[model samples]
Target: MQLTNHDAANPSYWQARWREGRTGWDLGGVHPLFSELMQEAHAAGLKPNARVIEPGCGRAHTGAALAKMNYIVTAFDVSKEAVDAAKVLYANETKLELVVADLFALPSNWSNSFDAVYDRAVLCALPQASRPSYVHACAKILKTGGLFLSIPFTKLHISASEGPPFAVDEANLESLFEADFEKVCHIEKQHSVKDSKIACEMLIVWRKK
Candidate 1:
């Protein structure tokens, strides 16, 4: 909600980052924890062929990984450069679909359309003010009882740093999603961003109430 000319939550901010290859956040691969989540989802009766979404998908690496596992995946980014990169990487991937779109302005028909919605750093990238809208959109697009896999950058809150990768602590999460979601698990232990400046992160899985 800090209105500023350089707000990290702004789409133009990310677009510039993509254009300049300043994506320090890109792991050059999918989030390490996502593989485990996919396995868990499968064991929880989520069929590999079921639909999934990767909102704010940068380069769509997670979507590509899911597609390889036979999941029907749709990933989108507000940055055209990011989406273009994803298209080039998964040009022949039938299970993966990448689109240039805003998370807040998603297609209306997508309501309750996904079996799962995955987030790894996307919410962290937004300004604190936008997190509510982001949460609402994610909830709107997921089917009842669908998983909400969130692995957010927790540095600003935990380590006290400026962020795009903003500060989102456990308390902030509780206040944000408690109205429409039930935490399926406790706020997880701190984890690393893997070879990055971010000291740690928080993991939480939610189920729509």
Candidate 2:
């Protein structure tokens, strides 16, 4: 399972991982944290039928779950294989639309079109240098006062050069999005991943300013 490239920012790196069937990150279903987060969002006035988007939606299990919960979901991935597979897996979910699109270059028509963005590890999957751009893109697609829900790994021992999931802590998150988003909530929960180096995941909800 040795990959020649460790470049997380490149789509080809992820495409190759899928081609090799090396996606250990796929949870096979919606993440355990999603239901509770949805509840929190709902309590915060995020209603059903809201336009929700998931960036780097691998397999789109969460996206499908959102669709099942009656939200309009648009999930996109850089890898065509990932998007195609997700589309097939959730074929019956009419409210869920999966597309292959670069997160940094999303369609112009999508600007300020989303009510919320679900970023499950998408930020950690990217190189650290790309975090600013990643946050900018997410903020760009969201309407004013829209939500940004993120579940990022914390206390990861590995460096960016070692590979993702990269270490992203509360400070790291605030540094990137504080300019455009206001922190609404931050909850720390045990990670589903088995790695010891990953202490936990921080579920941060930010409202666009």
Top candidate by TM-score: 2
Report the lDDT tens digits of candidate 1 across residue range 1-209.
33343467678777877887988888878776776666656655578788999998888888988899888999999999989998988888899999998997999999999988988788777777889999999999999888788777555433334565676778888888898888875445456555454656666677887
Q: Candidate 2: where are CA atoms >4 Å away?
A: 1-6
Local distance difference test, candidate 1: 0.79
lDDT per residue (tens digit) for residues 1-209 in model 2: 44543578777789899887888878888777887787778766798899999999999999999999899999999988899899889999999999999997999999999999998878888878888999999999999989998778876766656667787888888899899999888899877666655768877889999
- The lDDT leader among the candidates is 2
Residue 111 displacement in candidate 1 (angstroms): 1.0
**What is the lDDT of every predicted structure here?**
0.79, 0.87
